[model samples]
Target: MSATASFLARRAAQKERVRILYRRALKDTLNWAVHRHLFYEDADRLRERFEANKHVEDLETVERMIADGEATYNKWRHPDPYIVPWAPGGTKFTRNPTPPSGIFIEKERKI
Candidate 1:
């Protein structure tokens, strides 16, 4: 195989591994949350961290952290408000520029 093909294949495999780790971590987080409220308290922080670091190329390293017991779901909550999400792959958080108007807003406003 050409070097480019090899690189692409490796990248694909890496991404798949990352996805697996992500799913496992998500499952662990959910399980922990179900068992105790501490995990629930950290949900937002965990989501933010995962969203931030989700696209790192060295997925194995991150996976190791998740598997190593150091990345417990509760670790998401520490000091002050919370840790910021990393915005993985250099993606920015795009807020909705404008709110939806008219009927939907009016109907909800009644409650």
Candidate 2:
């Protein structure tokens, strides 16, 4: 691959990795925060952490920062992440094939 193409590919991959890391960190913060207000504060702090390094022009430095961010996120990851009550992963939403109780079906009328 040409040097420019290789650089662009590496940069794109790095951006994707950073995006994933940011999302994971945000969700992990939710696990720690009890209230929505607290979560907002924590999310802002996380954004600031990313914004602080948003202007580095060197690819090597950006890669190094990405590595550091990943390491920090891994070290601080929540042991048990919180799942939304209505989400697929949560207990309330998961169900078997059987229909829920209390629904009565009406007999179809012949025309």
Candidate 3:
């Protein structure tokens, strides 16, 4: 690939990585907010923070910002992340047995 093409590819990948990081951070924030209203405010703040960097044109600065953001996320991550009751990582799912209570499977009949 030409130099310009390679740089563009790397930049695209960096953007994608930043996008994924932002999503994970947003979800993690839910673990810290007890009420839905509080969560909306937290989510808005998070969106603003990410949007503030949307106009950045310097690749190096973007990389630095992403690294800093990731570091901050790691530093403040919830010790006990809140998982939805039906989610794989949550207690309701992890501690429950397979098939659950009301699920039914009808056997296929051979024609």
Candidate 4:
């Protein structure tokens, strides 16, 4: 029973990694694609690569493939990935954070 649970937990983690990798790869692809139509084409090709491996029933193979994909992504990742202005590490992040309410500091008057 413990073995089955361990296998399932590991499998779930691997699946999550694959999802993250795919999203990162897709976004990185967008960084390189200068036009929307080209991005769409790249996205479709990316989906096909994932779908091609969807039928593998072997857990070990799946694990290996996920690892390989992650390595590839990290190796060729964008040097400066695009970030939304309001997101963390973005230009507008915390740009104008709201001040705490009801706290006022009066400037000291100079003589």
Candidate 5:
């Protein structure tokens, strides 16, 4: 292969390796009982809340549920933002409105 082609191939291989590592780490973390417990608890709570209000056939209620789910997902995904040093009323750095595409590493994956 030409030099450029060889370099590109190597880069592709490295990217694949990184992706594999990311998937493995995520699987391992989620396999833990604590992770499973928290996930199921949050999921069950959300489901119960939705079911309790299922009889309310109003647009506003549906919208509220959607918003609540999104907020919960965000909080669970980024618990650190709500934790120390960035507690309530503290100077908080908002996330990028549109995160750049490609290989975005989550905080948990780094641990």
Candidate 6:
């Protein structure tokens, strides 16, 4: 690949990684904050932390920062992050799963 193409591909991958990191951090904030007020404050701080490096144009530096952030987040991540009761891996997950194909419940409506 040309140097420009390689840089563009790396930039796109970096953007995806950054997006994932931010979302993970936000959800982890919810796990740590019991009250909405505190959560908002924590979220803002997290945003500031990200914004602090928003202007760094160097790809290597951004990658290094991303790696550092991921490491720190993993170090402090909640042991049991909150999951919606009905979501996958949740307590209610698959509790009332759909019936098998051979066991149809409702009859089909004729057109």
Best by lDDT: 6
Off by over 4 Å in 4: 100-111
Question: Stretches of candidate 6 above 4 Å error?
Answer: 104-111
**Model 6 Cα shift for residue 40 (angstroms):** 0.3
lDDT of 1: 0.56
Q: CA lDDT, every prediction?
A: 0.56, 0.87, 0.90, 0.90, 0.51, 0.95
Each candidate: RMSD to true structure? 13.5, 4.8, 6.0, 4.9, 20.3, 4.2
Answer with 2 or 5, whichever has the higher lDDT: 2
TM-score of 5: 0.31
Clash counts per candidate, in order, are: 2, 0, 0, 0, 0, 0
Candidate 1: regions farther than 4 A off: 35-43, 54-111
Give the runs in model 2 whose Cα sits over 4 Å from its true position. 85-89, 98-111
Candidate 5 lDDT over 4-105, as tens digits, reads 797677556544643444343344334332666775665565456545754654445544655565465444443333233345554553533457678687
In terms of lDDT, model 5 sits at 0.51
- Deviation in angstroms for 96 in model 1? 53
Give the runs in model 3 whose Cα sits over 4 Å from its true position.
Answer: 94-111
lDDT score, candidate 4, position 98: 75
Candidate 2 residue 52 Cα shift, in angstroms, is: 0.7
Error of 4 at 3 (Å): 3.4
lDDT, model 4: 0.90
Model 2: per-residue Cα lDDT over 1-111, one tens digit each: 699998998888888988998988988999999999999999999999899988786889988998998899989988878778768878778555455688776799999
Q: For residue 21, what is the lDDT in candidate 5?
A: 40
